[model samples]
Target: MTTEKETLNYGPVLFHYDLFPEKIERHGKVKKVITKRGTFALKEAEMSEDERNWFTHVIQRLSEIGFHQVVPLYPTKFGDYTVQLGPKTYYLMPWFASDERNERAKDEVLLDHLGKVHALTLKEQDFSNEVVEHSYQYLMNRWENRQFEMERFTEEAEQKTYMSPFELTYLSHFHQIMRMTEEAKRRLRDWYDTCQREKRYRSVLCHGKVSRNHLIFNPSGEGHLLNFEKAVLDTPVRDLAVYFRRAAHQRDWSIEEGKALLDLYEKHVPLLNEERGLLISYLSYPEPVFNAVDLYCSKRTQYSQIELVHRLESRIRAMKKIRDFCDAIMIAPPPSMDENAPKNIHIHDEEDHI
Candidate 1:
């Protein structure tokens, strides 16, 4: 629990402490803060100068668009973002109204809200140098390093645990997944290179992380976006891909559902055929991302073995859903039409028609 003085120094809002086990984050601090102004999510993390600029730029831009997705309690001196406190920066945001629960939402409502967000233009948003280059470089570097880590981890796991059938099978799966991920990374790089070659590598300010959990609905059912930490200037299609991947995690989803969501997005920001293909191709990497996360979580000192296993299982499940989605798209054949064909229109008749 943060002391009164600590909370006072952190921001304008003083919060009511909740002693519950902090279910949302088992290993981290979770406090319910209250103040004369409003409540805010007080999180602590070590960030770099580049990351600081990224958040600053994103918050300033989102606020400018009147999106109301994320409200900075303490905005920057230029009224763009918040100030850093000590080595740990704190964000004073609106204490969401009581209505923002974790329950599932109907697909229609969710899709509509997402469409509205994607509709917002980034031209009016605040941005800075190094934002795009830093973010892109970070992702590319992670992809390269992560592949190496996965290969080494799989090898070690195989050498140590192959006595068990489950271990051997898992190692095999891990190796296969790593190779697929490497391919995805290569494709993504190619897409980036193509964009540069065509002089179409312009950055669009984006929410970076898009999901229902980051949304808050007001009394009138108006939805608000949140979680701007990952916001950075990169490919807009990458943002769309992240949303699609997350939406794919929901139940009652079909090809039509995905199409409807994408169609709605197209209304706001049209995507070229090639851009759409790039987004589709990028979907292949989530499984590898989860596998990397699984490896990292196992080494995290904060989590117990049970907690680690639970987190790994959830990520694996999400990855599996993404994999199944990829499979469905891959196995699809070109559309065929012969609804009014005559009875004699068999394989032999098809040759004659051609």
Candidate 2:
């Protein structure tokens, strides 16, 4: 199926690289370009001009700052890191094949690299009252709106004479879920109060989407991260929260395993008390379970009743795991930073970093 016509479809973008594809295999959004020279991953992404420029800048800046664990992007003959055609943007990198043997080590590598990225660019930003107030109020308003919607859903289900299995499952856990929501809101308030009192906050270069899938192992067995499309300068907790939330959904994931991983990460960059609270708040919100309910309500015909019920149950189980993890977090502080960390921490400005 790898014909000349198929390769030609991407020729306009490949022309800049001067590569003649012998074959191209589509893997998700990336095309595996098999040429006489070598195999490469040609990634197709949607990025505005600003996002494309910023993405290329983040990859390069990570290298310039001595954090080169990221996958190295290949440049074209014209020395451009990315190419554009119509509404799509394309970039190229060496095709690093996946290794199943290293699968178990993924979370460790992901968090470790994330910690390095955060520590290298960590900055204690001068507090801005206007900025802090706006951020806090925006998030609080959003959370309250979602809570009200869930309450309305519960009331509607209760009024029904005979509820569906999905409704029954939701009703059973409704009280526990609400408790978790309140806990998340309380923690968010604590974070906001601490920031206001201390007049301080920290920002770092965060891999906005932190997941095991974004990490790939090279032939040498070292893990190199890819997909920095959503990279940004923000609080370090943003990445940690994102990582832990996703991890909680896995069947083998445990509170002990989660805490051990957090300890490994804190060895590189220890989390402050407020940041820890923020991470807990982010994890406690049962948004995933709420999303399952929304999907059942909006698209029940698309999927079977049993499928929807199973999905809701799966999310509820994950929420329980997250609740326990939050409890363990409150018991102790993050482990100490590694002694080898530099005495002078690098403070990266948003404009300067990306």
Candidate 1 residues 127-178, lDDT tens each?
A: 3335435655777788778767666766676677333333344454565566
Report residue 148 deviation for candidate 1 (angstroms): 3.8
lDDT of all predictions, in order shown? Answer: 0.53, 0.90
User: How far off is model 1, as Cα RMSD?
Assistant: 12.0
Error of model 1, residue 290, in angstroms: 5.7
> After superposing candidate 2, which stretches have Cα over 4 Å from the reference?
340-354
Per-residue lDDT over 1-354 for candidate 2, one digit per residue giving the tens place of the 0 to 100 score = 498788779888889999989899999999999989999999999999999999999999999877888999999999999998989999999999999999999999999898888888888888999988898899889888999999999999999999999999999999999999999899999999999999998889999999999999999999999999999988899999889889999999999999998988887778889999998998998899899989999999999999999999999999999999989987876576667755545555565443
Instruction: Estimate candidate 2's alpha-carbon lDDT, on a 0 to 1 scale.
Output: 0.90
